[model samples]
Target: MDTGRKQNLKEARTLQIWNVIYDIIEVVVSLIAGFTANSSALIGWGLDSTIEVISAGTLGWRLHGEIKGLDERRVERRKMITLYVIAISFALICVFISYDSISKLISKETASWSTVGIVILIISLAVNPILIYYKRKYGHKLDSPALLADAKDTFICLYQTVVVLIGLLLVKWLGWWWADPVAALLIVPYAAKEGWEAFSKAQRIKNNIDRK
Candidate 1:
């Protein structure tokens, strides 16, 4: 393999490892924040992180076994499996959040919990964009759609964090109970978009300019 390809794979492997760590951390944080705030969106966010952990693990394992471009039947199967699992997981989370948020909206209850959630939101907002940019850099360098899709998902996470933060602040200050559920509702489109991206990854790769 060329030196450039070698370097690219190495970077992809490292990025996958980082993603694993980040996802684990995210799941933990979101779980705590969700329960504390009684926010279904936050709980659903935790579920998404768990799926990311699976996706990152699969990517890392697949990348580790590859010398360059992967052609083995097992590796290809693993990638496809990972893609399906993540796609299903994203859809599930989106549906759960939508249902939960709508219920909350109808009941008209404000979310409460965690000055710490706001703090977590601030940190995620600060960190995710840079990680996503690097993920995109590695994706372009490596011609890897999984990495790019994961980056896009992280941006959604960032957007959710911002929305949740706004919701929390409004609930705290304006006494707008609806703000919290509204914030959760705002995430639906992004969640579905991420789900579609996960589902489309391999198909998109297959339908390349050369294939078409």
Candidate 2:
């Protein structure tokens, strides 16, 4: 094997492991913060992180794993089907979030301050963009769709941070209670659009090898 190929494989493996750890930790923390503050945007964004976890899992398993023969494509196809199900799960979560945010907006929900969670998100916002640039740089070099997907997920965190920041700012500066959920509502479309693209890509990959 080429040294470059070996390096890419190592990078991919390292990235996948970090991704799994990052998503698991961050999403759990975000959910805790979102609920603690009753912030729709925060919670909605947390759900998005959960979806990314599924995407990363699929990317790692398929992109790095082995398929020895044509017969094994069936197994790979089944695994990809599972990934597609993850995509469906993302859509369902998005719908629920959109509905919840809208309902909260109409009902005049209050978004409180979670000092710790906000601090956590602030750090996440600071760190993610750099990672994305790096991931895209490498993913593009290797033509690794998995890394591309992970890069997108990292960028989504930046977007979610902006949305959450809006809500937080409105609450902090203007005392506008509705602005938080509204900001979250605005980002739902972003989440949906990205997830749809990822789902389509996964479906394409699966369909290419799926005999059934």
**RMSD versus native structure for model 2:** 2.8
Best by lDDT: 1
Poorly placed runs, candidate 1 (over 4 Å):
68-73, 202-212
lDDT tens digits by residue: candidate 1, 1-212: 79878878888888789878877887898789888889765676577667768877888888876755666665666676677787788788788888888998888766786666666677777778888898899888888777787777777777777777888788889988888778877877877876787678655544452353
RMSD to the hidden true structure, all candidates = 3.2, 2.8
Give per-residue CA lDDT, model 2, range 66-185, as digits (tens). Answer: 322235675467456656766687788779788988898889988897786687678778778867877898788778666776787778778888778778878978999988888778
**In angstroms, how far off is 67's CA in candidate 2?**
10
Residue 91 shift from truth in candidate 2, angstroms: 0.7
Lowest summed lDDT across 10 adjacent residues in model 1 is found at 203-212
User: Residue 22 in candidate 2 has what lDDT?
Assistant: 83
